[model samples]
Target: MGDKIVIDARGSSCPGPIVELAKAYRNSKVGDTLELWATDAGVRADVQAWAQKTKNQIDSITEQEGKIVVVIKILNR
Candidate 1:
C-alpha cells in the first residue's frame, strides 16, 4: 500500500519495458510494487513471462488507450 515505483516505458519497444522493470526491481525493496507503462503490445506477455521466470508477483495488467500498465510486486528477492 506504499507508493509504488512507476516506470514509464511508453513509446519504448520490446525488451525496453522489461529492462526498465529489471532496473527498477534491482533498486526496489522487497514487497514493493512497480507500475510499468509500455506502448508495445508484446510487453504484457513478455513482462508476465519475465515475472514468472524471476518468481515475482504480477498484481494486475491493464490496457488503456494503446498503452499497457503492469503492476508487479517484488518477491523472492
Candidate 2:
C-alpha cells in the first residue's frame, strides 16, 4: 500500500474533475488510494470510465451532502 491522496474539485464542471484525477494518477503509485471530491454530476460517470480505461479499481462512489466522493485504488497497470 502507498498513501491516500485527496483531490478536491468541488464546484468544478465537466472535465475538471477527471482532469484532476488524471494528473494525480500520473504521479500516484500502485496501491495508493485516491479520494476525489467533486460537485459535478458528470464526475460519477467520468471517473468510472477513466478507471475502466486505466484498469484501476474503484473502491467507492458515494454522495455526501452535495458532493460526489470517489475512492480509487491505483493499479498502475
- Judging by lDDT against the true structure, name the best candidate: 2
Q: Where is the poorest 10-residue window by lDDT in model 1?
A: 12-21
How far residue 38's Cα lies from its native spot in candidate 2, in Å, is: 0.2
Taking the tens digit of each residue's C-alpha lDDT, what string does model 2 give over 7-66? Answer: 999977755889899899999999899999999889989988999999999999999799
Would you estimate the TM-scores of all the predictions? 0.88, 0.93
lDDT of 2: 0.91
By summed lDDT, the worst window of 10 consecutive residues in model 2 runs over 11-20
Model 2 clash pairs? none
Candidate 1 C-alpha error for residue 4, in Å = 1.1
Question: lDDT of candidate 1?
Answer: 0.86
